[model samples]
Target: MTSIEPITLTGKFVTLEPLSQEHHHGLVDAARDGDLWKLWYTSVPTPEGMAAEIDRRLGLQSQGTMVPFATRSNTTGKLIGMTTYMNIDAETPRLEIGSTWNAASAHGTGTNPDSKLLLLRHAFETLGCPAVEFRTHWMNQQSREAIARLGAKQDGVLRNHSRSKDGALRDTVVFSILEHEWPAVRNGLEFRLAKYSA
Candidate 1:
């Protein structure tokens, strides 16, 4: 039973609220932090287009294929970033965590790990998904390393996976955590969050 409520998922350091237009202003400010997303070619809507983008995401929600969220810092109760469970495949018990962008201030903090922890727990523990996927542009070394640090193994890159916003072919590097691997991944994420919070 999938529920349509705006479920709130909280971790020790961050909270995830279902995406809403109300998050627009905070997200607009958050986008000014740095060019952390400059190299990303496939990320959608962008800072300038976020308002309409949020509406587009909500449209996808009605199709049951994507669930987006506004990431908030628990300490300050400020919206600091966004993440999503996209490319959802309920029958295959899989989802992809992408379209994630964080403000400059929260990038290296405990926010990311805590956010992922909450989502991972929900997807694997509560929802009983067999696997959860994380994909990023092939050139995004920072993201690839971050995913690896979360204990997700590299699943190879799909060359020419899609066209980028800039009209270039994109290669997507995929990573995943299977149900059997959740224990180690979860523990590693928790440890990382603890270290960051400390």
Candidate 2:
């Protein structure tokens, strides 16, 4: 199944590898860079919870419901974050790219965009998926803007979509890019990446 495959996706700035225990320490350091776990709307794991989080993701992978990745920086050769193709529906051929977080240092450094380029390319070109979804907490304006920057259109908000780990109700903002729209999105990503190279 397209959504269940474990594969590496490489880009100019980042490489997406199958998440493993070996990435545990690097991920802890990356998460600590910005104390990302402090963000109320996000589910970023604290250093102490990193291993359990990895286990959860791997468990989901074993169930054929998610494909997780450890994102490593090409320049630093360091794990900077994690991402995944989750909420997978193989029959519909759709997957949601979620649970993504990066080190503070990797922000605005071409890491995010290039990583998206690779994921989007794989989802559309390799997997032949008709659409891919992205969801974030409504309170996370940074993530919403970043998703829009990748040429995804807002699909609407799901009020009280789910309960967060802290027992708070989460309003999820969903966005998506369709297969037919991939060409334009690809062009936009390439154009954005060009600026970093320049």
Candidate 3:
């Protein structure tokens, strides 16, 4: 069963489009906006390594383990970042919305919440998923706050869950919104996005 398919998810501020090699240059420029790769906790690719990273993500998508998206800003008409539906468990029909990074310029622009709202709506309303998970490095306080703002509860921390891009052992902070909780979460996200328009 192909639980996750590449699909375009449009929102007021951003659209999550299926990933492609053609997005490489745009992604690289996004990375350079804040030297995102230099951050120790994130897995963002360097400008020179963008193509290889895109290929790797596509390879995983082919293997049915991930569905990656290119985050595009509707206002700018440019690729601004990337996000993915990863750690897919087809049997449970659940997945994690992760591996996400955005250009520094895109921060505080409602792009993140808009993306989450779109992803969560499709996951729960259309895909019939019971739970949608989010995982971030424990050190990434900004990310943790963002996930929390989306109404996800902390599921707990996984000690030494994985390695960061800098090879540092990472404590993964897991969060989730259950099927029962999605309604409130969706409302909260929508309220947040609505502010961008006002």
In model 2, which range of ten residues has the least summed lDDT? 1-10
Top-down lDDT ranking: 2, 3, 1
Per-residue lDDT of 97-195 in model 2, one digit per residue for the tens? Answer: 999999998999999999889998998898878999999999999999999999999999999999998999999999999999999999999999988
Reference-based TM-score, model 2? 0.97
Task: Report the C-alpha displacement of residue 107, candidate 2, in angstroms.
Answer: 0.5
Give the per-residue Cα lDDT of candidate 3 at 144. Answer: 94
- Which portions of model 1 miss their true places by more than 4 Å? 1-6, 35-37, 40-45
Clashing pairs in 3: none
Model 3, range 42-124, lDDT digits (tens) per residue? 78998999999899999999988899999999999988999999988877899999999999999999999999999999999
Ranking 1 against 3 by TM-score, winner: 3
Cα lDDT tens digits for candidate 1, 1-198: 453334789889888999999999888877766755475544635578889888988888778888999998888888888888888887766888888988888878888889889999998888788999999889878888889989999989999998887888989999999999999989988877777643
Per-residue error for 35 in candidate 2, Å, reads 0.8
* TM-score for each predicted model, relative to the true structure: 0.93, 0.97, 0.97
Error of 1 at 34 (Å): 1.3
Please identify model 3 stretches exceeding 4 Å from their true place.
none
